[model samples]
Target: MGLGPLEIGLIILAILLLFGYKKLPDASRSLGRSLRIFKGEMKGMKDDDVRSKDAVSTTPVRGEIVPPPAPSGDPNAQLQEEARLAELRAADLRARADQARSSDSSR
Candidate 1:
């Protein structure tokens, strides 16, 4: 059931005949690009899975209101608070982007 070297060679020959030598490089380049994009998307999905797991692990239970820490007058405390807020904003943006991408893909 497996293709031997001769069969494989014939397939390659057929492809070459269908697409001349001048076009072969372009075809291969496109194939490589497609493969790279596919790999990147797979990696993104894995990252999303890990991120979801981490979020789940750190999330507060239902009916809980985890308020931000009380404001401290210290400058360092303010900077830290700002940094945390920035991270939250960035996460929100990423979620939106992911949603958009999913919707686009569905279409």
Candidate 2:
């Protein structure tokens, strides 16, 4: 019925003839190694599931969706203040240069 006995024997004979006896052992060993690797990968996935279950969320405010806290002071405003100070220093230097030139010409 399902490939009787004679057909099964013929199929075995064909497989043996196509891939000799020694080659069959080697092929089976490599197939076994591949199966072992597949089993290890499945076990690794189970380990990952366990790790995820054990992990804790790190946020202090876990439930609140608050906007980020504002900076203590604005950086742009501080930078503008520094720029104004630098401009005043440059104007003072230019005035000093003009006075020195005037005194030198008079002398």
- Per-candidate Cα lDDT values, in order, are 0.79, 0.70
True-structure lDDT of candidate 2: 0.70
Q: Across residues 61-94, which tens digit of lDDT does each residue of candidate 2 receive?
A: 2243433334568978767755665565556557
**Per-residue CA lDDT of candidate 1, range 1-107, in tens?**
99999999999999989999999999999999999999999999999989977864465434344456566668887778657665765576587679999999999
Displacement of residue 68 (Cα, Å) in model 2 is 22
Residue 45 lDDT, candidate 2, scale 0-100: 100
Top of the candidates by TM-score:
1
Alpha carbon RMSD to native, model 2? 25.4
Q: Which stretches of candidate 1 lie over 4 Å from their true place?
A: 61-107
Q: CA shift at 41, candidate 1, in angstroms? A: 0.6
Clash count per candidate: 0, 0
67 Cα displacement, candidate 2 (Å): 19
Screening candidate 2 with a backbone cut-off below 3 angstroms (N, C-alpha, C), the clashing residue pairs are none
Candidate no. 1 TM-score = 0.54
Q: TM-score for each prediction?
A: 0.54, 0.46
